[model samples]
Target: MQITVNKTGGFAGVNQRLGPVETSSLDSGVADQVRRIVTESDFFHLPEDLQGAPVYDGFHYAVQVLDGTAEHTVILAGMSDDPVVARLHELIHLLDEAVGFQWI
Candidate 1:
């Protein structure tokens, strides 16, 4: 499995890309964390587009997950109130920390 995260449109307007990282390449704990987050967020069940209205100076996130023949993509606005969005944000932040980028 592979997961990719692209973050854009923050207050600094800086765009960041983190991984097409394979789950097997990560530490066992990190891989488990990623799996738990994906499962808890129900990421595969979410719509492909999740941009809610939009907010000034808010960030935009694009997450893609590939598991064998299945692939899911979700685009979200930073300030969305949805629980899924909140979970995604948290997952992205965790990934950023793991990868040594503070773009979130």
Candidate 2:
């Protein structure tokens, strides 16, 4: 399993990419969390674009997941009230802490 996170459209106008983070190379706990998050959040079936409150200086997130059975991406605004979006946001934070390759 692999996951990539891209954060863009922020105050500084700088874009960042986080992985293709290989689950095999991560700690078991973190890797398991990724699997659980993807499954429970229905990551694969989510709409590709999840537009949010659209704050002018807010960040945008693009998360791509590629596991053995499927591949999908979800893009969302940083500010939102949706539960699923919140979950994805948390997942991004988790990745940032556990296997980060870029600044958030």
Candidate 3:
């Protein structure tokens, strides 16, 4: 999986860069988990309800599952306070790159 980090404006703005993550090379473990989640998740369900302390004070998350695609997105603040959460987020993005929503 190639995690591309694109740096946006800095020294003036918040240095926000919504980099693109391509998840092509997926290990068996991650691949299996993602497949299971996709199958089990409520496709008819509404957007996940996230109610808690915001990951980023001003930033909001916008996640989308590509239509007719298997790629699922969980957009949250850049990173989470917990390392595990951050890692999981990146891992999901990698899944997005690997098996897109098409295969689903």
Per-model CA lDDT versus the true structure: 0.83, 0.86, 0.41
Give a tens-digit lDDT track for model 3, residues 2-77.
3322222223333333323333346777656544444455322534433235433444333444433444444344
Work out the TM-score per prediction: 0.85, 0.91, 0.35
Minimum summed lDDT over a 10-residue window in model 1 is located at 95-104
Q: RMSD to the native, candidate 3?
A: 8.4
lDDT per residue as tens, model 2, 1-104: 89999988867985888987988888899888878888899999999999887789888888999988888999988467888898898889889998665655
Identify the superior model by lDDT, candidate 2 or candidate 3. 2
lDDT agreement of model 1 with the native: 0.83
Q: How does residue 76 of candidate 1 score in lDDT?
A: 88
Instruction: Report the lDDT of model 3 for residue 49.
Output: 33
Which model is ahead, 1 or 2, in terms of TM-score?
A: 2
Ranking 1 against 2 by lDDT, winner:
2
Error of 3 at 20 (Å): 6.4
